[model samples]
Target: MKSTLLSLLRTGEGEFVSGEKISDQLGCSRTAVWKHIDALRKEGYTVEAAPKKGYRLAGEPDTLSVHQLKSRLPEPSFVKDILHYPSIHSTQETAHLLASEQAEEGTIVLADEQTKGKGRLGRQWHSPPETGIWMSLILRPDIEVRSAPQLTLLTAVAVVRGIKESLGLDPEIKWPNDILFNGRKAAGILTEMQAEPDRVHAIIVGLGLNVNQDYFPDELADIATSLRLEKGEKVSRTDVLEAILKEWDWLYRMFLKEGFSSVKPLWEAHALTMGKEITARTPRETLKGVAVGIDDAGVLLLRTKDGKLHHIYSADIEV
Candidate 1:
């Protein structure tokens, strides 16, 4: 009921609704409806209550509420709980802390804005509120520590597939964890886990997708493009987020039941730089090579000019 009210309030233009009408429609008393409206007003909603016209939704604050998100989700059952923040340092950071306390799987921590979001190799992920989708999913996968890296590749495929299905945009995946549209970055994935040498622990996958941002900074103008920019229309963040979770659940189940053999072929087929010439850079050294298919371990298989195939565990790659 709260989510419905919020959604209707955000419809941008609506006439004032009378208390009797709301009470009859919602099966509640007029006083009860007034209480609900008051609660919303306290939460930064500007609701106008006139003598005859009971209540009018004037303004709604920018907040990612669980009620609103779940209302938009096709399958909200898969999402156990949603922790929404108006502003946070990072959703991944909060999720990790929650995991330490044995938070349930499918627990999602989403932030409208991440002040200090991180990408691979501790790189700063540029997350501006209402410009992109910045969120994290906590999963307690039944897999060994060695198999955790494969989750990143699996998530990459899921994200690309979801984008294609939802927006009709043919996005491509860069090896490991990047979704590129029109040769520019559209989304990124960061996978973190807590495990011993052999056993497994919880894995928190952080996703940052450029959704509605129309323009990029001069430095990233040529390398970063959002879904809205590419499609020339604003995309609903809620719709995209729901699609990603649904697709991720599918891929994740496959990986658990069938292993990497199931998703490897699909990922390779959608790889953007698989057959292209590229340079893979590691902290130790950089290797120039032609991109080949990824191994079962989700390592990037780079065949250098010297005819030696190197499995890159972690690093930045340039195509």
Candidate 2:
């Protein structure tokens, strides 16, 4: 009901809509309409209510909610179901629970802040309130467990494409999952999966994108940056999210039809690690080498100075 009222006011686009008209359209009393408008204001919507003019939506807040995001999405199929939280331990953990309960594909678990947010190799992701995009997408892909890692690369490609399209910035992909802007980290992708040996269950792709932060903490000051910091102005998080979903939907369908072979070239085009001297630190050991490229299974292929080729299944790369 609140969403409906808000939508009506938004459709008015700063013009006043009478309380009587709102009550007639929503089949509610003027008092109820006034209550809903009050609620909208409380949720950071600047709704103006005059004596006779009724109400007008003056401004929107920079917050992520089901109402705001759904209103911005181009199609319902992009996000069939969305779970929004003001603050949470982790969107990835909640997404896993929802997927286990048979949540539909394209369902999203989003939060303004994540208390226990994580990145690859179990590192903590910095997700401050209302300044970054902390969301997990639940995907049930019909592929083998060995092929599941390819989705991470595909997601990186989609994110780069989305950022380019929305912000007009060409961010570079740092091998496995980091998105960099001017050599500083802008986003990270963590892809986890549940599967049998031969078949797959669900893949949860978690994305943490710094959007509107003015500055990072001392620990992250050297490496982390936000869209606003890069662009020198605030960019719409809704627009970035929508672009990502559209790119994800498009690339996912392409991957399904043509496999990772078709998607690998696109990922390579925006890659920052390729053809660069780097060090890859895995669980067992670290190796310094020139990053040749990715192999057929999307593993990083590193050519060491000793001229031996190494396949990296999972590693942290430093360029």
Candidate 3:
């Protein structure tokens, strides 16, 4: 009810809203309406109240509140709560803290901006407030530890599908965790897990999608892009976020039921590196070969010139 009233107040171009109109629209008493307005005030909203005018929402902080995300969630997810911060060191770090405290699966931690966002191979991801979606999901999956790498691939599929469905644009997965649009990077996912060698514990899937950024940092000008830059229009971060959660939930359920063997074909078709000649650099050395599809264990298969197959666990690839 409070969120509804605030949304209504935002639509009005006046300095104040009549208390009677707010109470009538929300089907609450005037006192109750005032209480809601006070709560919004406490949450960093500047709402002014007057006898002639009901309540005027003058300002709102850029926090990802439960009421805000709940109104945006797709019908499929039961997003119990959202832990939001105006700025955080990292969503993954906060997610680890929540998981240690036994936060429920599907509980999301989102930040308007991340001070220390991460990517695969310990690279830093560029995240700015109101410019990208920087979020982490705390998940507890019933799967073997060895099967974990598959989750990264699975999430890539979800991100790609989400962007396509929500923005009506085609995006492809670049190997393990990169989402590419028009040969440039649009999004990246970082999956960090805490578990025993053989058992599973918690998986914090962190994703950062460049949504409305028009300019990239000089260092990232060659490789990064936002949906707005690519599509020539600003995209709704909330809509894309909901689509990603919905797609991930569906794919995750299927993965738990049948494992990676079932999703291998789809991943292969969506993979941008498949059947292309590429250079993959691992920690020890670099290899150039034809990029074949991944095996059941999610290891990259590189077909060498000597007609031999080499398995790569993690690497930065160039096509």
Q: What TM-score fits each model?
A: 0.80, 0.82, 0.80
What is the TM-score of candidate 3? 0.80
Please write out the lDDT profile of model 1 over residues 154-186, one tens digit for every residue: 989888888888888889998878899867999
Give per-residue lDDT, candidate 3, residue 295.
92
Q: Candidate 2's residue-wise lDDT over 1-319, tens digit each?
A: 8878888888897899989989999999988888888888888889888998889988887876578667766663557888899899999999999999999898999999999999887789999999989999999888889898899999999999998899898899998999999789999999999787787889999999999999999999999999999888888887898888888888898898889998999999999999999999999999999999998779999999999999999998999
User: What lDDT, from 0 to 1, does candidate 1 have?
Assistant: 0.84
Ten-residue stretch with the least lDDT total in model 1: 5-14
lDDT of each: 0.84, 0.90, 0.84
| Residue-level error in angstroms, candidate 3, position 256 | 1.2
Q: List runs of model 3 lying over 4 Å from the truth.
A: 1-65, 72-79
Clashing pairs in 1: none
Residue 271 lDDT (model 2): 95
Which candidate wins on TM-score?
A: 2
Candidate 2's displacement at residue 294, Å, is 0.8
Regions of model 1 farther than 4 Å from truth? 1-65, 71-78
